[model samples]
Target chain A: MAAIKGFGAYLPEQVLDNAALAAEFGVEPAWILQACGIETRRVAAPEETVVDMAEKAARACLERIGMEAGALGGIIVGTGTPHRQFPGVSASLQQRLGVVGIPAFDIHLASVGGFFALATAVELCERYGPILVVGAERMSQVMAREPRVKESAILFGDGAGACVVAPGEGPVTVLDIKMQSDGTFVDDLSMEFGSTLNMNGRTVILQANRKLRQSLTELLERNKLAATDVNLWLFHQANVNLLKQVGQALGIPEDRVFLNLPRYGNTSAASLFIAATEAQAEGRMNPGHAVMAAFGAGMGWGSALLRVQ
Target chain B: MDIRAAVRKAIQDMAQAPLPADDSASLFTGGVIDSFGLMDLMTNLEEILGVKVPDSELMPSRFETVDKIVAYFQARK
Candidate 1:
């Protein structure tokens, strides 16, 4: 129902390269790189909170269209690692942007949260002309207390990404959006309050592969579009291996998928917008259709079809 | 070849190494394969074993060990 005008990104200044992570884990940097396909990740400075990063990205989003904060009808944030547990990131972000009373809220779907927020904004944009959607998180801080996981510890970094969704056609309009989740596997990938982040690597990896493939396959069928018809594949930056697995299963070529997880690791909810922004800047988003797939905690997953305007 | 032999060869190919002497040995704990390997096994089921692992039947635990994998396919048959 709405078009995404432009995208904005904000990555913390501190770069946590593989060397430092490997040193902490007592493994070779090369091993980490080979195993995870990550080189460096951004870690928010101790003083920088989720709102701080979200503000920068939000400002950039509005600035792209020369729009003022007052022009936005609402703000929707997708984040699991808010600065505080009491007030969500969206409220604080609204205050920082100097906007008040516009129905700001947060979605706690973990990795797929960003895609879910954007999908909701597409429908809400009609009532709220130009809504701001941001996916930001301080993942390093959230996972700090969790036990070191050889497969997951080095997979997260801190960053923020945002997009402006306007009521009518502008830049890229979403044609269709579909989301589904099953609570049966809730504990497979979850984080409890005052408890460490829990992840069953074997189950998570296998299920993620199946779920992502299904999401993309179903989206193409529902839209009456072929997998080859998608101009760009802006999937969640979960991992290089998982992406490759899905791509192969669907017979989608590696070049069609836009990947940036190597430089930023998995930024959780921020992954999609961050990768989508990079793809647009790189001139890959010409006037055509793009498919975005995301899967994460809650065993949640979704797919969206976008038409480049 | 019997179902067990065919499944064993598929597992060995996925592991890309020699199989343990015992059929019931712990493949996951022995570092023979990880989560990624489990996915690879499922995707190749049709090509290697002529088995189609339906989405509902795709459980990581069912394929964790060699004997468990054999039991799963055998039961389905």
Candidate 2:
């Protein structure tokens, strides 16, 4: 079975503290903290592209595994905020990593894109040997000052996380990955091409809670495991309260959940892997079963189960 | 607990702040509750009132205030 041999993440050095946002929006800093549990988030510099973050994260992952870029058989980048419209971020990442001519592509599933890309990598590993999967986003670039869009602007950050999926035994063996989407709620949260993001915050909250719970349940059932079996629960860092509610609904203990939203806000596609990598760094992830779940625009949601090796 | 009291309690517990004594105070427009707080209120209401709010009826207006939430659920019963 394909396993996550190594994992890495990168957050921009610049931090956008909630106090600054509160002052800019004329709201209480406590309100922003209470509403989403985000105290600060990373902001990308003007010159930092999605590929830049992806390359750093990918390099970290490769370094942890002590592997060279030339050893990669394929590359998959999951992102909704690509630097260019035509050539996916993976293309540039391939060139930067000196792994050009390898199969490279991007998945645009927004927040849940990381899980989808990892699932694809698991399958591609059979044909390609070892695959580099990166979930990166420069969400700050899309932030707009429009009144209606301000809330979303506060909710997103720029970051990237990557994992090296290869044919080997490691700390985590991917058991299964399941994904689903409903187009009806596509309008609930979206950014049309060339435009800024717009969202029905209330609707998206309700839909995200429902979809994440449903997907996580299905994944657990298929794996013949119960929620309690998951030792480490890495959910997309969307909102702290939403994650708490979903964990409560699933009967998962609060301590089992790993959250970094307070520091990173919502990094969209990069959220899950970033949390995973952080959990590992914190020594929270042990040799046991773990689950990762995410929900995003396209009303897409997915969950992946892993057995810690 | 009475429906109004239960609703108020839920809001207070979830928001960690007491609602205005006046029942007519706006919950949504006044920023008394955000979307996340609304979800918590729903879960608490379901448990306290012993009723499931159908997804179809989960709208902002129906629970815009403490009185409105109490009245809506009472009417449903």
Candidate 3:
């Protein structure tokens, strides 16, 4: 079995609030707020590459555990917003972290990318040592080019979150994880390489609610656990209202849900880990079961259960 | 509770604001409910009205105003 040994995140210094976006888009500030439930989002500096953010987050995670880069058995990055099409962030991250001769790779699962990486790390941890998983995204670049998609541009931000997974007993234990995708809804949300992001917001919202509910329900049932047994519900920070709807449908109370989208907007793959770290830091995550659910582009969605010691 | 009152309460609860005095006021165009808010309003309606709005019926024209929402449910009854 594998457990989360350390967690950390990197959010850019720049902040883009709703008022600035509303002024740029020629809409009322309240419109942005009510539409996506986002007050502000972080924008990466021009100099901050995806690898830079991932490196920092990885260092922070390693620092938390007082471990060095050489201690990592492998590195896995989950992201859709890569700096370039070739040479994924993992190779550069490994070099920058000074941990050579270790296997490293990237998983492109859109917003649910982080959980995909975590699940991969858990499996690797069985035969390896500590594995570093980072979910980093530079989404603001896409938004900057396509300012016309006001709703999507305003909802995406740049950030990265990282965690060190090791095989041992710890506070956070990975019990089970499941992921599924339906290509039929591929056009619901998508962004081709070097192209602007496209989304059918209403249809995506409807599909996400249905898919996330099904995934979470099946996860709990397979584990023989009830929704109430979960003390914390962490889902992708796509939209606050979407999360609320899914939680309501599952009969999970609002108090049990953990959210940080208002501050960071939708950081795609990084959202889940970002919220998980912040929730644990704030003492909201007690030593019990926590359910994490995420859905995004590719019409993909995933859910995982963890027992927090 | 009455159907109209239930619809008003759902809107109020989702928007976290007082309902408009005029029932004909547009909930969508008037900015009383947004896309996300609209989704919440639909879920709340299903709970309060004891009816499931099929995906085929989830159209903007049908949910334009409080009056239309009430009318739609009334016709179903």
Candidate 4:
């Protein structure tokens, strides 16, 4: 069984409210918020880099476990915002965590990077021992300096999150995972210039809804878990519309879907971990229930079913 | 202040600190400026140099180097 031993996250200090962004773009905040499930997004400080945020999250997770970073068998970072294209953010994190001799790597699946990264950590735990997975991004770095992509400018924020996963027998375990992708949908959500971020709203929404609903159904059926078994449905916090559509499609009930998109916009890869952290802190993931979900870019998506305890 | 010099000074102030001794070097390629750092450059041009830089001018190619940024501002003037 795979158990989440600890978790932590860092949200940027400034909040770009939906109303403020709406006024800036001459759009209606109510419509935008209702459609996107996003109200405010965090912007990173000039001094902060992708590596810096990831390091802070890694520190937080390690501190939570009452263990040192050196205790981990490996480190994995999920990000599309590496400070440099060549050096994997995970390698940088391992250096910062002082885990010099472990296998560390980075994966860039846009929003779904976190899920893919976590799945890799789960695989490592199956092969070796416990592992630390960190999903971090400094996306404000990719925002156009002149507010060119006003919709995107107002949509993205920067942050990081970390979780410690260990191989153990527990009531709470990662039951199953399902990931799928179609490169044809790649253009649906992407950044055009500088290999950064450029999203086509209509297409991204349509494809995400299709994939999310399909994946959620398959995951539930394969695990033999009913919708009623899921205590918390943590989908990627893309926008309000996608959340509503997915919830309605799956019959998971709106109350079961954990949403903070209105508060944080889309932190890309960091969304799920942050949601998990908040849900746990809020006592939403009590024992004797289950949690299920999917998310992110490359138009990539994955869903994980977990037993709650 | 002359328009060209104002543009030049704006470029200098926003260029990576300890401005490259030679202005021909590409700011981004030289590791002196990044996409976020370009924000300070854009803001300096807008607020200090009294230029309204529209969103379109934020492209990577246009603002790759100090010379290019100055050229962009001068052309707008």
Candidate 5:
């Protein structure tokens, strides 16, 4: 439906590594390491807003492709930590980029927010030239390090990831996508307008294990491919073990799966694009097929299949 | 094996840690079973007790204690 013209991400300079968390949580570093293999995660400065991060990431993305903001047809930002509920991040980011007269909006699907935007952009680019899709979050500001909410607090970091979806480009083609949501476990994970992060860790993991695999399976099957058919696996950078489990379940080898949860932690909506951009820059993406998937609040999950030509 | 015994054994196997002496103690609060351990316990329960917990009732709290898990299974009986 569309091809990713360029991708970019911005990670804050502050480091929240295991040693720092060990002192904060009053637990040894090994205890935290037992949960996830994450060594360090990024934290946005206190003053940085979601739109500000989006602006930086968007500009980097546009710069990567040598395109200007005025050339973009529209903007869609996927984030849970919008500066304010009214205008949201996309409108503010659009203004920050000095563009006008185009539809710019925000979708809050948590981790899958960016994937949903990308899946939608693949189709929208056909109608509206090129679209800028960004997933940005300031998770550190929202979630405190209190013991009660500590389960998810340690797992989240802050950053923004952006990508430009062109109507038709080469080298990488958006082939097919599958999205799913189950509101039954809505209460399992939540963060209100003024509230911080809250979630039943077991429930999130259980659903993520099931949903991520199912979505990936359906997409691969519909395209007459198997897990081995994909050259690279881009996941939401949530947890290494969970990603490994899903990869194993889908018959994808461990090496094929790209994981950056150690360095960036879970950036919610921003994770997928962050991983994609990093992979593209690292030249880890081989010329074949890459399947990217994400799962987050709203109990939403989706898979996007892309072909590299 | 009784339902409690089977569930206890599954939890013990998956936990890889010493459990509370009291069987009704909260596993999640006590940090005995995490997401992976709980899922394994569920799969073990389905096989060990022949009671497939409906997806709707798979909340972590329901299986927080062995007694609650037993009651859930008996409720379906």
Candidate 6:
């Protein structure tokens, strides 16, 4: 078993409202909000990159864990967007931290990246030591700067979130994770370019909804757990409506769903970690309580039953 | 093998399968090549062709299908 040593999140200072996007794209705000469930989203400034946001989040986590950079066994940054084509974001972060010897790498799980990255970190920590896992994405860079009314553009934000995990026999332990993939329907929800997000609303909903329900149920049953056992449900903040629909189908109460979409659209890989941080800060989780969930891009989906520390 | 077939084989291996049924449509637009799948494809292209596909060239239009991928390499050659 391993414990989450610390957690941190960073939301850029900028906020853009649906009305602003609607006016820019010649679409009604109500339509966008009703269809996407996004009222506002965060945007990174020109000076901020995915790596920059990740650093801030990782620093906060390191500070909370009371560990120096040199103590880390590994650093895994989960993101699809990188500052460049080579020398992954994780390597740059390792260099910036001046932790020269530790192993570092970047993963491209897209939205479900946070969980996937965390899962990988747990494995690395078991084999090595404490790991710093960061999910940072600058989705704003992919937004269409000129076309004000693009549907997919209105549904994402830029930010980063991180957590430090160490081996411990704590009450909070990662129990089980159910990951499912159906590559046959890959074209439904995706980015059209390195700089642009392209999503087919109908297809993404169908795929996400079906898989999310099935996986969550199987994970809970396999672990011999019930939905009532969970204190929080930190879902991937991809689509506001999608989250709502998935929640409704799962019979999860609205309060259990930690939402930052109004403030940070879809942060992609950063969404879940940020939600968990907020939950902890609000004192919503305690030992013995379970945190159950799902997230990422394959539109990959994973559900983990975690015991609170 | 010709460039087109070679590119197709490269993508097939990257996806861990034979060529997808429709090899002409855009992979991104068609949703067949996802971010992870695309990364896998890029790694194959770099290793197989011995040419680095720049980050800027990782768009849907460029690697939509086996034909387009081969064309990209052909032009580069």
Model 2: residue A187 alpha-carbon error in angstroms: 1.0
The Cα error of candidate 5 at residue A199, in Å, is 1.3
Model 1, CA-based lDDT: 0.86
Write the candidate numbers in order of decreasing DockQ.
Answer: 1, 5, 2, 3, 6, 4
Q: List clashing residue pairs in candidate 5.
A: none
Please list the residue runs of candidate 1 whose C-alpha ends up more than 4 Å from where it truly belongs after superposition.
Answer: B46-57
State the C-alpha RMSD over the true interface residues for candidate 3, after superposing those residues. 3.3
Candidate 3's TM-score on the B chain? 0.88
lDDT by residue (tens digit), candidate 1, A163-279:
999887778888888888877678888998866788877778888898888888888888898888988999889889889878988988789989899999999999899888889
Overall local distance difference test of candidate 2: 0.86
| Cα lDDT tens digits for candidate 2, B25-53 | 88866777877678778877888888888
The CAPRI class of candidate 3 is incorrect
Tens-digit lDDT track of model 3 for A85-112: 8689998998898888888999987798
- The TM-score ranking, best first, is 1, 5, 2, 3, 6, 4
* Model 3 regions lying over 4 Å from their true place: B1-77
Cα RMSD to the true fold for all candidates: 1.9, 3.8, 4.7, 17.1, 2.8, 12.4
Report the C-alpha lDDT of model 5 over A1-309, residue by residue, as the tens digit: 679987899998889988988887788888787877778898888788888888889999999989989998989999988888788899889888888998899987788899888887887888888999999998888886343454566788999999999887666788887777889999888876677677777788888887776688889889999888888999998888888777766789888888888888899999998999999888988789998899988888998889887
The window of 10 residues in a row where model 4 chain B has the poorest summed lDDT is: B53-62
How high is the CA lDDT of each candidate model?
Answer: 0.86, 0.86, 0.85, 0.73, 0.84, 0.75
What's the TM-score of chain B for every model shown? 0.80, 0.87, 0.88, 0.72, 0.86, 0.72
What is the C-alpha lDDT profile of model 4 across A1-309, one tens digit per residue?
687787788887877787877787788888667545676788888888888888888788788778787788888888877788777898877877777777888987678888888888877787767788888878888874554566677677788888887787453577776677667656557765465456755456555666677788888888787777788887767676667766775787788889877788788888788887777778787775555455666767888888775
lDDT of 1 at A118: 91
> By DockQ thresholds, what CAPRI class is model 2?
acceptable
Model 6 has a DockQ score of 0.02
Instruction: Give the share of true interchain contacts found in each model.
Output: 0.54, 0.23, 0.12, 0.00, 0.46, 0.00
Pitting candidate 1 against candidate 2, the one with the higher DockQ is 1
